[model samples]
Target: MASHVGERMSGSIGVNILLYSFYALSYAIPGGIILIHSLGGGLLDMMFSMPMSRMQESEADYIGLMLMAEACYDPREAVGFWQRMEAAARRQGEEVPELMSTHPSNQHRIEKIQSWLPHALEKFQTSDCQGTSAFADAFRRALERGTQFQTIYM
Candidate 1:
């Protein structure tokens, strides 16, 4: 959320500068040329901004997973949640190319979570959650079972 806010603030500043520039140039440039420039600028902004937005989203996801594991909660549940989200999207026939979207696709998120699970699991194991809950037991079992790509449906 902080990243999003920062991005929005920066984007707003950029737009303001563009708006001021457009106002100054309006008297010198033809209206048709100004319109074309505005459209092209908007397209370029979107092309740059979409990937940054997706990166922010992925960063948030990674932070959330780490925080959850640090809190001794199961990071594997993150994968399951995203899996369900992917399933829901599929059911709705909703698909967007990653480049055009503001967020990473669910499958992409799942893959990243899987890749980071070993670190998160290590954090979970070292945290004060030992013998604290059923989730702890499952974590142990998963470690014993080899942690990668294992989904824990909640």
Candidate 2:
């Protein structure tokens, strides 16, 4: 019985890694070299593709927030996480730089996350499975939105 549980757990870990790997690759293809090879960014993708990806990130964050609520996470966490991320970036202050910062200003994202909190909290109070599964679903949906062909590139 214990071995069976271990086997199931190992299988689940494999699935999660596979899911994330595919998502990263899907985003990377149109994203160009910077998305894949950390050291080989195409000039055009660097100049243009990166910023477009940032906007998509912001859009995805809000979309993710909604889906998290729908799947019953405490979406309120988005507010705090964004705020902390912003403060960290400000501290970084161009020392290292980013490839594609798809996040909006932390303050803006905090406000957006705040707007979703009440509903998310309500869902959190009602749901089962601790909400991680819902987050995984939201991730899959966002990855589904990425493509080899495209729309609002930025």
Candidate 3:
């Protein structure tokens, strides 16, 4: 479990870095275009960019969920993760309208995940691995423990 989790976490870190880099580059391209052309870039530019940013975020979520599913982690957990993130954001007083935010709203994320879950579950089910490894079992136990802890404390 430790090894699997470690590998997944490491891979996730790399993937996230790559995704964010792409997102930054995407923004930079438009900003550069606006600056070079003197397109009167301002709130309007930002407003136009918002949809692209949200799309990037949504793409990242979809890819991440698929990666997790491929790694044998239940993709359903993604919904809980987003819910917790939303709760945390609320606690931090960072609530923002979905249209203005770079990322989709948590409700939207959860709904998106739910929409994709059947495909994720099919991937999990069709995987050749016949049985759970001890590592997977331990990982699941740890995840459950973490969920319980969050429920009790958060």
Most accurate candidate by lDDT? 1
**Higher TM-score: candidate 2 or 3?**
3
Tens-digit lDDT string for candidate 2 (1-154): 1243454455546555654565567674786435434533354345554555555655677677767766755677777787788889789883234554434556766776787677667776667845577777888888778742356574
Q: What is the lDDT of candidate 2?
A: 0.62
List of clashing residue pairs for candidate 1: none
For model 1, what is the alpha-carbon lDDT of residue 65?
91
Instruction: Give the worst 10-residue stretch by lDDT in candidate 3.
Output: 36-45
Candidate 1 residue-wise lDDT, 1-154, digit = tens: 4567877688767766765676667667668557847675666556666777888888899899989998878899999999999999999989787777889999999999999999999998888886567776787888976644455532
The runs of at least 3 residues in candidate 1 whose Cα sits more than 4 Å from the true structure, single-residue gaps closed, are: 1-3, 11-34, 134-154
Query: Which scores higher on lDDT, 2 or 3?
Result: 3
lDDT of 3 by residue, 52-145 (tens): 5676677778888887787777888899999999999899999898886767899899999999999888887666544555677888999999
TM-score for all models, in order of appearance: 0.69, 0.40, 0.60
Better of 1 and 3 by TM-score: 1
Q: What is the lDDT of residue 53 in candidate 2?
A: 57
Decreasing lDDT order of the candidates:
1, 3, 2
> Alpha carbon lDDT of residue 30, candidate 2?
83
**Which runs of model 2 end up more than 4 angstroms from their true locations?**
1-55, 70-72, 95-102, 129-154
